[model samples]
Target: MALLLQLFFAHKVTALSILADMYKKRLIEDKEVVIASIVGMFPMGVRVVVLLLAPVAISVLGLKLGIIYVLLEVLSKFMVALIGVFLDRKYLAGGVLEYITNVSLKNSMLDAFKQFFKVLSILVPSIFLAMLLIDLSFNSLVSQISIETAHLLIVVTGTTSTIAGLGVAGSLIATNEVDGKSALLLLMIASALHRIVESLRFSMPVNISLFGSFGVRLTLILLLMNELASIFAILGLFLIINFGFV
Candidate 1:
């Protein structure tokens, strides 16, 4: 049963990848609708299937292989989610053109879906990579390191991702035809707004839901190259944990 389940999930991953690659370059009549369906269906499907089979695989493969498999699964989904978000947002929100014309950042319904994909893309892979790298470093310097090392790695990865994201945001705004300074100012304002929303979540129920929804929605779209960094992180972590730096 365990073997069968693993095989099933592996096959599902393959099929989903094929579909994503197929639609990668194609433009559809309804970009948002198609992108939403793809985003909603693919990662969730992979997540559910993997979660179900993971325990069984873990028992069979031991901690090392088990973690590796999970890392790969998380990273792959993250990449797909990132790409899906961009594709969806571009289609639904009309990309840079609409954003500048409207001067409003509130994403539409379809945009929400894209956002979720973008956040997930970043969160899943980042978390996995952090886990992997800490494990590796710990093993390499097994005598010198402590358990706190793992937690420290998490902090580092999160901070790095945030800083990198800010850089990307600034670059995007600067490149816009609108006044570069103005674009940067608008983006900074938006970031401040998002921060307020994040803070208010603790005391305000409505704001909590709003930011939570926003966070989830935003995951649907992230830069493609960031996804690769996440993959490397996961691989590095797994190597450290599994092999030890002997």
Candidate 2:
């Protein structure tokens, strides 16, 4: 699974390189683009490594500490991004430092505050609408399922299908001690299938065809998740775990 995800990430990086090439003034050098993509893959690698090593870590460190280490490792990428941004500004022309120096701090703060509120304005209502829709749909479709299944349904279909939903669902799972495998599976499926409404909302203003974009994205996500390589990788992890290899 991790290997497949890396391949998908590489594909995205290739697309980004193509897009950069089309611009008259390239933001990043050709070689640097590939380097950046490889560097970016580190987080995915960390995720896989942590999951693979989790059993051993939990046994050695205890579950709470082990989970904390895993979370910190995942979040460490943000530090890497921060350092990358700093380097870009220090070494590259027309980087973020130039823009930062040009803008007034007060204005920047005000703009950030406005944007925060603006996002909240959109998000609060969308969340309520999503909740209402999920309530209606689940009641109609499968009202007799267990509480865990109900939560999974809400997470998959009743929230934004992007990173926002991932955070929300992850928090719920952690708090409720939900089955990790089930939560991961549902989250992946949700990421692929849901968010159509959000995608349409963003794409319409840019004149992109909603159906075309959604179809392509959904197909790619499903394909990557279901690919034989990914399946075998996941199976390998299970086999190792079952054999007490950790």
Candidate 3:
């Protein structure tokens, strides 16, 4: 179940659906689902990705904004720890040290490995397919963006995809068409606005189909939480830029 949680937890709606289903089935309580909502948004894999992307962001967003980007990911993780892990520790399970007295270490390890890999075989491929489809769709949208518009166009392109926007922003910055600070701000605006559009088209409908009214409710909560975070980030960035504080 820890492995399954690891798999689902990265995709926010997927995580919420699983957790919410658990609640409906009485596997866990409502607070477990709601409080751990941040985990549905950030998850463990995303934290790893954030670290991996830090240097790339530095090169694209430059030193200051890049650091801010990393901090945003950290903020999400911190929320998960405070809200999710604190409320529900069941997924943490037991370690070898903790299980040492209860069972044969060799048998335990062998059985655990077999069970984990058996589930992994099914889930890993499904996850890969989902990721590939999403990437293909986003890449198609990104390919449509024209970086020639520079400043304002960066925002438009960003609404298509952040990766697309970042590439466009980098080009504009290179040509001295837009500054790092303004580029980052526009990116945030595009990202925040895009989130709304995406929810309406994809997540909202899909979730409602699966979980009905509960899905609508959960979807809204997650969207609101994420949007609020983006709002604060934008305001914080604005202040730093305006004050020349980097």
Best by lDDT: 3
Q: In model 1, where do residues sit more than 4 Å from their true spots?
A: 1-29, 49-51, 94-246
Shift of residue 212 alpha carbon in model 2, Å: 20
- Candidate 2 or 1, higher TM-score: 2
* lDDT scores of the candidates, listed in order: 0.39, 0.41, 0.58
* Candidate 3 residue-wise lDDT, 48-139, digit = tens: 33433464556666777777766664564455445556556654443322111122447544654664455445333433443453445544
lDDT of 2 by residue, 1-97 (tens): 2332343233332333232343224444533432343344344436433433343334433465345434433444444434445555565555231
TM-score winner among the candidates?
Answer: 3
Measured with C-alpha atoms, the lDDT of residue 136 in candidate 1 is 68
Superposition error at 105 for model 3 (Å): 22
Model 2 regions more than 4 Å off: 1-28, 34-111, 126-181, 188-246
Per-residue CA lDDT of model 1 for 31-88, tens digit only, reads 4423543454334536442443254324323444445544544555556556667776
lDDT of 2 at 23: 26
* Model 3, runs deviating above 4 Å: 1-14, 29-32, 48-56, 76-149, 242-245
Question: All candidates: CA RMSD in angstroms?
Answer: 20.1, 11.7, 10.5
Question: Which is superior by lDDT, 1 or 3?
Answer: 3
What TM-score number comes out for model 3? 0.61
Please give the lDDT score for candidate 1. Answer: 0.39
